[model samples]
Target chain A: MASTIRVRATSNGDITEVQALIQHPMDSGFVKDSKGELIPAHFIQELKFEYNGKDVFVADWGPAVSKDPYVKFSFKGAKKGDDLKISWVDNKGASDTTTAKIS
Target chain B: MTTITGPLATRRLILQGAASVALIGLGNLPFAAQPARAAANDKYPEEAFKQKSEADAIKALYGKTAEPSDKVKLDAPEIAENGGVVPIAVTTTLDKVTSISFFVAENPNALAASYKIPDGTVPSVSNRLKMAKTTNVVAIVEADGKLYSATKEVKVTVGGCGG
Candidate 1:
């Protein structure tokens, strides 16, 4: 599926940090049916973040995770205008990549 | 000797067998259809969570006199194209944030989600939420031995409940 990501940066001028948000269903198969059948859990197993070709963040996720997962974190040394790239892959083998620049 | 008896008994047996088959099939219909119904009924608890006003959800999660604070930063889209999954993130620069949570003001239940912040981990969390319609999304953060909050309006374009 096509994915979109947005990045926003708010700094105290001392620390020019950035926050990124991604959109995807991190479904975990634990949900059950009314007949008591299990909804197979599907979720994002891994995520990788890079800033100008340098690895910045990594996270491992599971079914307990909510759908359309969003991720946010801080990174130092970024200016008012820099590139932040993000990509994620789910257990279902679906993946998306996008980028945001500091503004 | 009398001719072979009429086929009345044989015909009766055949008819009885057919009737039994029909009855069995009818009896199993409900049973066969139950699993699907059960699955559909198995919506996330948040679906039943009553849609409350933003103020109400805050009170429910914190207490009668919950107050918003600056320590909590809640981020979400201004307009969500689909209500099925809306991305949400909660972060706090608070010195000691113990936990974070997401609550849907308009959902059937009050508390939509909760998270425990582990020691050594940053006081932040992100996840997708299932929204039934347009509603206010509230974020609660337990930090520095107190609770703080922030909120944003999320517009759901498509209903997530098979609507």
Candidate 2:
């Protein structure tokens, strides 16, 4: 599957900043389609960010979140050439994982 | 030309077999079980998500009241032409920040989004949100076991919910 995440990580002195955009529909189940039927809720329920095998950031989301979520965070203990991985699972049991290198 | 069982019995057996196969298929998918496992131990804040009033949603989520803080900065446009997607950004300089949650007082559901900030991570987040009508948007930050918040009113020229 194509990677659904686009990440940019850069280190400024000691703090390494990470910004990511995830592709998702985030259907809230409240919206109705053209047929006037409620769309079943489909959203990312959990998102985890790891830096060199250590958990750095985690998010628990609901259907209320908007489509194509954007997240930005920074942490210490990460240098250039370090590995940053992000994974997320949706309410429908679909998920995606991607890795990026800190610049 | 053999004796046949009842239709209901046969249907039940077929359903059971299908269910077992579906369960096994889900188990085989690596990511299928991930959310289920986390949800088993995590709280969903059902009441909070269902609330319509801001006060009630905050009460359901935090239980305690939140005090206004200047450290919390909620950035959004003073006037949003479109309510379908209003960009919001929150940043705080509070020590030991734990979580940041957003609430739209006028939406069908008050609690819009909630984010958990892990230790050592910067206490900032940005996302687009849907607004049902022109209303106040609140950002609450939890730090050192205390709740602090900031609020901003966004004027929507066009409603997002077909209004």
Candidate 3:
């Protein structure tokens, strides 16, 4: 499966807000394919974000979630051009990470 | 601005897309990209809730043998320019509604969203939903072991990105 994840960080010399959008089918693995065959279940099991060695957000999701997951969250005490790291792992053991600088 | 053309553009989309899927961090098994099914006593337990028609959507949320009642109210815009984020509200005049759910019949997955209504929180909720096209929005309320419903149609002029 292919998707896209975009992360944008904005800082005003005091607060840093981050927004992320991930494209995914979020299939719960309970449906049948075109031939009416049962498709295997799969979904994101966990997600975590860290900034400057501090935990920002952690989420445990199941199949009930939606497709192209989108998240918006903010934190205080950061400046423009700072690095923010985000990562996610699905039930299938797949993982990826990306970084963005506050602008 | 940079221009990406022909096969390379398609390749870029796929590669970028693959990176996103990897970020999702799915499980050990192969990634399955199908929608979740509905729960038992509902419809397709593993697939997203769907309805062939407006009536079917109502039945899935309420129950196959459930009957329609006026206690449930659906509030939607008379017209919307963008189907991506149309504001909708569901309120029930009934005494106690255990839960409330909204459904879009024409969407790839009929079950748009659902909410668990706790006691004394007021039997109403408001949120935005993406409509593939002009379609019926059905509100299903579970009250005192019974399911009641109401629906409203919003005219959408412009569909979301995918249409």
Those runs of model 1 whose alpha carbons end farther than 4 Å from true positions after fitting are A1-103, B1-65
Candidate 3 segments whose C-alpha is farther than 4 A from its true place: A1-103, B1-45, B48-62, B161-163
Minimal lDDT window, size 10, model 3 chain B: B37-46
Go through the candidates in order and give each one's C-alpha lDDT: 0.60, 0.81, 0.61
Interface RMSD of each: 7.3, 2.1, 9.6
DockQ of each: 0.15, 0.39, 0.03
lDDT of 1 at A62: 39
Question: Which candidate gets the maximum lDDT versus the true structure?
Answer: 2
Which tens-of-lDDT digit does each residue in A1-103 have in candidate 1?
4555666765554454556566655443434668777667566655666766765555444343456566565555556667767776776788778877666
Better of 1 and 3 by lDDT: 3
Cα misplacement distance, residue B46 of candidate 1 (Å): 11
Ranking by DockQ: 2, 1, 3
Model 2, span B33-148: residue lDDT tens = 12221211245555567667887777767766699999999998999898877899899989998788899888877888777777778899887887877999999998998889
lDDT of 2: 0.81
lDDT tens digits by residue: candidate 1, B24-82: 99996554332221101212223112224545444433443345877788988988887
Q: Candidate 3 chain B TM?
A: 0.64
